[model samples]
Target: MKGNETPRSTLWYFVVAHTFWKNVEVESFLSEYRFTIVIFPTMLKIYRGANGKYTLYDDGISLDYLQGDSVQTLIKWDDVAKKLSLEPASKQTATRTFQVELIPDGVTKRIQYSGRPVELKF
Candidate 1:
């Protein structure tokens, strides 16, 4: 309920990967009443599952921040891999998995969008 924290009702859960960039084994946590604060310079990746489930990956530069599904900030985004791109889902078919890393603008690097989960191999 704080100024920086988003509502817990909107978020179901979130996964975070901190410092362990080599073989990231992200941790998943159910959203709680308390606020999840993430420090600056952290990179966030939001993804949706194939069965229409939303997931948040908080790749912190130094800390973690869960429950940011309501984050609506304007920023540039680039596909993590050239082979993967974000596209609209067809009427009869769901979109494939893809990931787009947020490009930091020195202000905010978080964004809420529609994306599918890619393997956490990074």
Candidate 2:
């Protein structure tokens, strides 16, 4: 995404999911979908910044979705099950973010993400 591109200017929704893992080296599947991390989970509680960015407290690791060429790409899930699989493991504790375009007439109705402004068409 371009620096000049105001994220809120476009019609989009943010999806957040989280889970915990005992001893798994999970590669956060972020770039596959378009989303900037507002917070990431760690051994303890999740630490979120005032600006909606996230980081792992103890580990000092931050989740950045806008650093690479794959940041603007969209991911396709075959079905609801597939989408659920993408969610962070609920048992442990992790946070994942996803950006979805709003389609007013789609069968799966679109809902606005909190704090995001909505654009109305006349």
Candidate 3:
């Protein structure tokens, strides 16, 4: 049910039943076991930046902690270039800026409701 889960097909279920119930009625026992699989939409995408930090998008936009955050989710990871955003923080300078943003809890607590970082999740 947690984020760190791998979806397994019927074959995997069968194999697992065999492993745990060797020399027993594994098939019928496993059939009795109910698996309520919940599927969540693929909301986030991560791209390894040239600078080495993993840039998180789509996922960050949904977090309550980020609701007041100024960091913009400019574009989908695939649609943009190999590098991230093409725009700068200011027109006068070429200071590189990432599209996504994260705010510290101290500031968020002073301003808004908080939720765990859904995007930065491993």
Candidate 4:
């Protein structure tokens, strides 16, 4: 990540017009996730179907880094982000981690938890 790039941590929110809910086409309320690079100016997201299957959304992120069940499989997150070079300082394997969370019913429709990349090493 660029040294000058101050990490931006903001929630990705969705505000339903309420009318959209009344529309017949609105058969359901969908579950979605937003993924942000935290430090880098990158954000990624995915959706969870009623069937529990996941569909990815393109938020200007390369499919390679967050291409898999990265959010669900948070164990190797550091490695994945590094592979994507989202963190230029990631040369040191297993160095840092980007925390991810999926929040539902949060005051608004939004991806939960946004902030600077916090290092959590056991």
Candidate 5:
């Protein structure tokens, strides 16, 4: 405990996925036969902050790709904001004061475990 430290409500984490590329491939089986396929891929970006906490900010596809319409598997930013507490942390003041408490690894681990039960099978 520092003398001039202010404890924060909850640390924020962000995770985001964006459409990076779309491609079509053509293949020839024989001299007179041909096949074509279309492919779309998304790129995921994650930032690991203090104590190994992950950040995921969603624009659109991550929610659908993760939980879909009817399932409640993954937690969204809105849900996180509602369920957990939040405090603003700026780059300037972060250096001077301990504005946030280090959430125990076990708690985050449980959250990560419970949030996404099913893995995307390829």
Candidate 6:
């Protein structure tokens, strides 16, 4: 929740990642380069199992987004960097919510999204 540190919860990360990459496009060339095609964005969900393993759900994302279920084939975190990299040119009226959870020393902390990132305190 600070700097480059994301929430440890896979679910939270997944939601963030999904929202960040909600609108993505891919372009490819057809055989002989006669035609070009645009690919649609896919929906993806991520969660952590009780065993501490990460599980990804791709029911919403199109086939273009997945090479396999394994994390390696899934889009990397950097893929959505542009979305998360936005900087407010000026104070806007629009706002959104983001949630964060932290677990340390057997203690858990929950933080709610309050629009501006400056309001967030890890």
Please name the candidate that would achieve the greatest TM-score relative to the true structure: 6
Model 1 residue 5 distance off true place after TM-score fit, in angstroms: 15
lDDT per residue for candidate 6 within 1-122, as digits (tens), equals 34433332212233342322222344444454355554432322222221122222332346633554321111222222211111223233223222222222122222232223332222
What TM-score would candidate 5 get against the native? 0.17
**Model 5 accuracy (lDDT, Cα):** 0.23
Candidate 1 lDDT trough over 10 residues, lowest sum: 16-25
Question: The CA-based lDDT of model 4 is what?
Answer: 0.25
| Each model's Cα RMSD | 14.3, 17.5, 18.9, 16.8, 21.0, 17.8
How many backbone clashes does every candidate have?
0, 6, 0, 1, 7, 2
lDDT of 2: 0.24
- The deviation in Å at residue 4 for candidate 3 is 23
lDDT of 5 at 23: 21
Candidate 4: stretches off by over 4 Å = 1-46, 50-92, 103-122
Cα displacement (angstroms), candidate 4, residue 28, comes to 42
What TM-score do all the candidates reach, one by one?
0.18, 0.17, 0.15, 0.17, 0.17, 0.19
lDDT of 4 by residue, 13-122 (tens): 33122101110111112234533232322232212112121211222235544543222212212322221112222222232233222223112221222222333221
Against the reference, the lDDT scores of all candidates come to 0.29, 0.24, 0.24, 0.25, 0.23, 0.28
Clashing pairs in 4: 1-88
Off by over 4 Å in 6: 1-93, 105-117
TM-score, cand. 6: 0.19
Against the correct fold, how does model 2 do in TM-score?
A: 0.17
The TM-score, computed over Cα atoms with residue i paired to residue i, of candidate 1 is 0.18
> Is 1 or 5 the stronger prediction by lDDT?
1
